[model samples]
Target: MQTVNLGIVAHVDAGKTSLTERLLHATGVIDRLGSVDAGTTQTDTGEIERRRGITIRSAVVSFTVRDRQVNLLDTPGHSDFVAEVERALGVLDAAVLVLSAVEGVQPHSRRIMRVLRSLGLPTLIFVNKIDRAGARVDELVADVRRLLTPTVVPLGTVRAPGTPGASYRPHPRGYDQRLAEVLAEHDDDVLAALVDDLPLDGDRVDEALRAQVAAGQVHPLLFGSALSGAGVPELLDAVAALLPPSPPAESDPRARVFAIERDPSGERVAYLRAYGGQFRTRERVTAYRREPDGRTTATRGRITRLDVVGAATDRAALTAGHIARVVGLTGVRLGDQLGSPAGLDGRSHFPAPTLEAVVRPREASRTLALHAALLDIADTDPFLRTRVAPDGGTSVLLYGEVQREVLSSTLVETYGIEAEFGPGRLMHVERPTGTGTAVEIIGHGFFGTVGFRVEPGDGVDYRREVELGSLPLSFHTAIEEAARAALDQGCHGWPVTDIRITLTHSGYWSPITTAGHFRDLAPYVLMQALAEAGTRVFEPCRRFDVEVPADRLGPVTSYLSRLGARLDGTAAVPAGWRIAGVLPARLELEAQRRLPDLSSGEGLWSSTPGGDRPVSGEPPRRARTDGNPFDRVAYLRFLAQPPSRPVAVRDAGPERGHRSPR
Candidate 1:
């Protein structure tokens, strides 16, 4: 049987879980439909997700549709869970974007659609909850077109009768003309025949619609009321007929490591998608690592296991399909592309993290345990990187607050370590503001002299690149590392950004200084270079959208102003007014509390990292005068100019931590 790997994506509370339950029931994978409110949904099996009644992570389920094995990935709808959705899309052959017939297209739905388009995946739209009163199929379709592309057209509609807030029967084919119009648009020949008043065959039109959908030129919309299983069988038929089997790309022999997983047994498994060529068990594959010294090392590991979708009755693995837990490859690392003789370079899709914070165990004894646990988690998700800070802090790069929370929880639960997360701070970059010259004299009369300039560059905004040449490769690497170390902690104790450095020219002795000596001396010279160029701190700003009843708009706006949030505008939504704004991330927690009180429990809000903006005016002075530890000169000359130690954090007086909720 053929195999297909597909995913269902939608906004939060848009009936994704309901649709998933109905699909499972229709395919006979489950004897009964699970309820999301009851927290019995198969995909939302995580304890936290079940408790919260929302999907926190993506789940994969396997089932059969019309004799073809299918693997379905259900992704979270909340923006905070977008990382899971992004990762799931990488391995999917197709995607089903779910929309509520009443809510129409939401901001997150449009965002997910845009991501799918960028990934070039074949997409299908399912307008769910049609049986709900006030569900307008035509209006929602138009909204989808306005928000996303115009490729989607509804195939049919489901009708049920009731007032707004009441349930109705799942009636089929109540409106056939709309379905005919959509089907006719699938092909020019069909439209011509329709215009000529010629009869159209249902089977031929179905074939044409399937062809258009497979080609990605059209997105077929199917209506279904998952609550009552209305139009579910027709939706299943559409999925089986329109979605093509995973194409054979195993001939190319190169596999890209798109994801990594760790089984319950504590083994690391690299999830590979073979863009080309077949992989067999026990074959020796080469691995490459780009080191800090600008050199690449080649290693080898034997493939211990091989599996494919549709290989088992459970649909474990198949060609061009999703597979998991195929363990036994010992030496493979995350993002390593495996091939027969030559290996492929697997770089991450997003930029390396720019923000970092210290995560320390509540008890000092658990430091190593916490470090080991974080390392293991980092292997599965490469975006969150960890390194030891210069001040003996465990520095971790995070995507955002949600990721930070997950990491903290994992550290606590997996390793029995209680971790305290420090404040989120900006990760900065360093560059030369102008042309300058420096000389490095090392042991045994070895001298390496160079002219350098730091300037700004693109790619990762607010980062500076050091462009240098004329020095030996070893010396060049040493210089780069030295520059990075210098910028590791910026003047304001934040990482630098949007700067570039150029080693315009250099002179060096061949045997006088080895790479090691240069590496050691580079940090001191880079510090001087950084001092020559002024440094500044940049803070992160978040774009937020808050929804509240119209009556509470005035209070919502007032609260936003008090929190230093700039109101972009307000739009009328079905539930309330959507107040759009940009606010500093540090104030987010307080803002969340204020909004609920302002709207009296009737307000909702969501925010994402919109990128960084300058912290307006000069930042407030630090309460203490303890200088930053990252400064080399300050530490080297501590005797001449002593720095203050950190003050003890004392418990507040009786009156503190006792504020009443307003």
Candidate 2:
């Protein structure tokens, strides 16, 4: 049977979930259709998600379309959960991008399209909710062509759009001049044939259209109302007819872990999208992960249990193009490559969280429990980063308030602990302004000497001037790992980025030199170098798009200006004034909150992540989690303290709580 891993993606409230429900019902996977408003959707089974009427986690379900097996992954639509979407993107064979007829092309819609195009994933556009009030089928289609790609060919037309009588009629499957014209833009043969007025073969045109769609160069647009079940069958037919299937599995086994969840008994269950070979029950697999230094680490684990999609038994083999729920790979994490990393790129598809909020327990006594729960959540969603302060206060990195709210609710519901979150703030990073070097020798009760030279560069580049054969690989790995972890909190307490660090010196007593010694001393030496280099702090920024009544443009622009927005461009639109600019991420929420009032509730505001810039004024400070290594006296004492003593080093990266090797 053929297989395709499909994803349904869209902006929030664009009816993605509703469409999922419609597809499931149409496929006879479920007898009764679930409603998003009532919180009864199959994919949205969490209590909190159902109550909120949104998808917090990506859900997977399998159904057959004739001889093809379709594993449909319904992903979160809200921007707060875009990391979920990012994870899903890596495992997909193709995607269905949903858009609302009334809302037309939204900011997130454009964002999703950009990612899909970048990945070259074949996509089909579903313009949903055609039977709703204010639906503009023609205008929305035109806008999709203008704002999105002009390579889209409408598969059908909607009759009586924006009314109860709305219906879809697919264009006849024949030689179409419009389809040929769209294809001609990319195909010289088609263009020549059209120009020469030669006979066009429908079979040839169909084959060319299929090839282009599979290449992601052309998109097909279909109009439907998911709520009314119109045009759904056509969409389903397109999935089987137009989109390509996953390639056959290779003899070598490989799978990418995309989603993770805990079973009812709290055992970790990872959803794997297999690319080659097969995963069997009780089989051992090696998991490979790429580190910050661009080095790959490997660990082995046995699969205690396995559940293959569309299989009749739990022990069935999970082959390529299928998804499975596997347990007992305790060290396996989201993005881990099982068996091999051959076909997967370890780069992140989405931007990191630019906002963070301090999470505090209401009773103050459950701080430890709150922190533990948060760590578990972070393990599931790697982008939802958690930090611990010296005072035991915990903060979580986030994309926006929705993530914070969901976190708060999850803490209360899952862990039975009430928590409060502080106001969100911009997450800043530091970069070294100059070059500086520091070295710690073996005489100070430690058996090793490690040196690092810090300089500005792109990403966390680590190199070595010392000979590779000078020390054991274990010791070298320890130094590289410690160096990367130290940069997690730089001189100003922000994660230092875009810097190059080179190991310039290394010396240790042969028998007495333990990897732990290098690990312990590397941070102190690196921090000293960063301080001498004088790091600069940079704050995140966002590009904003605003539309308001022509009469309210002055007030809206004035308010935005007061909030420190740099208006890069402006134009007059039929609805109002369209403004584009860059705004500090710290003030984005405030600007969004006040836009409606400024425009008398007729304003439309949207923003996308823009690269950060250095702060112009005095830089803000964050609570230091790493021992104050810049202060020689305090750091020496910190290192001298006994292992049993309570200390401020609660923010250890990756290896947190593990005793240092002696």
Candidate 3:
């Protein structure tokens, strides 16, 4: 049998979870239907998810449908937990976009559709809640066509009378009038058949639709009520009959681990999508994981367990186009590429970690333990980054206030570690303002000394140049790697970015000063170089895409002005105007908060962090620290660190009231 990885996605309360439940029960994957309201759904196994009645993590369940074994991913609909959705998208062969017939196309759904298009995944539109009163399928389709894809066509007749226990047949008039034109536009053969005939044969239509869908030029629209089990069987049949099977995983041996989980016994489980060869249990694998140095390494681990998702049996081997759980990989992380990576980057456009907060244990004695635990949590959720302070306090990056609350609760209930986070703040980075050069020397019998010139970059390159007299060619890699690590954090507390470090001169004694010594001392030397180079603050900016009516362009531009946005340009869109620009990320939130009112409920907006922009209105201030590289006393104080303490945590509810520590 063929394999398919289908993702069911939607805006909150659009019946995405409900659709999953109906599909599972309808396909006999489960005996009874579970309810999201009742908190009894099979895939939402997390305690918090069950109680909150929302999916926080993407979960999988498998079923055989239409002659294919399909692994269905139920993704989180809440925009706050969108990272979860993005992770699942990386493994999807195709997607089912769930939209409400009554509520129509929502903002989050449109945002998701944008990403789906960018990834070029075949998509099927399921207009759910057809049985609901006041549902307007035509209006919903129009919104979908206007905002998402214009080529979306209705696949089968909805609400038409047919023989009981038989398949849904397309209404000849609807098919000839709407879908036929769409198919004809895409395939000359289909157009020939349509012109030469009256009504399209179902098989011919299915073949043409599948071809276009796979090409991502057309998306089939199906209508249904997942709750009433109305039109669900047709949706299932459409997926099985119209969608293409995934590319075989056995073609390559590489797999990407998109998520990580812990079993009840605390054994780590990694959710992997085999892009290539088969994975056998007890096989020693060469794993490649992205490191802090921004490179992948050969971290070897043995796979001790292999189980198909939602299946009871443990399989000795798993192949491509399959999602499975494996254990005993000690060094794997959320985006690690297993089995040589085979030219896979394993990096997606993950949302930047913008919110920063200080964390400490409620008990002062567990300071070091608390710090370690925070890093552990960050490893699981890459969006969360940890910063350790000299005072034994730790800080973390977060998405929003609710995420902060969720992290606090998880720390307490899951890890048995209670912690409180300071109020989250916008994370800002720093960069050098002017060019400068500095030198570090090893006296007497020591091996070598290094000199570097640091300067601001034009945003295209951040590199290290080796000038003449740079030790042996083999030693350059060690020095380059060390210099990059040192540049990670600049003169200010913020991370350093967009700067070029050139090796102006090198004096080395090859015998004593090994690569290890150069690697160890390069950071200290680089720090001094950056300090002499001088530094300035840069705030995070977001790139915005907005669409509104032509008449509403004035109000939109007016709103952007208030948000301190620099308008890149605007173009004519079918609905109205398409505006693009860069704006302060802080104001991006403000824009989100007030968009409905500004757009009068008819506008669409999306944004992603666009990296750092220099302080425009005000003279930029420098990041402050007590023992920074510029301060020699503090630099010496850094050498004697680490007298740990136990920590204490207080329950700060969903809305964190504190600010990140200075």
Best candidate (score: lDDT)? 2
TM-score of each: 0.73, 0.92, 0.84
lDDT of every model, 2 decimals: 0.63, 0.86, 0.74
Which tens-of-lDDT digit does each residue in 113-166 have in candidate 2? 989999999999999999998998888878789667889899889999999889
lDDT of 1 at 86: 58
- Please write out the lDDT profile of model 3 over residues 337-422, one tens digit for every residue: 88866645545555566777788899987777887877777666666677665346787777777677677777887877888776
Cα displacement (Å) at residue 468, model 1: 12
| Model 3 vs. true fold: TM | 0.84
Ranking by TM-score: 2, 3, 1
lDDT of 1: 0.63
Considering only N, C-alpha and C atoms within 3 Å, which residue pairs clash in candidate 2?
Answer: none
lDDT for predicted candidate 2 compared with the true structure:
0.86
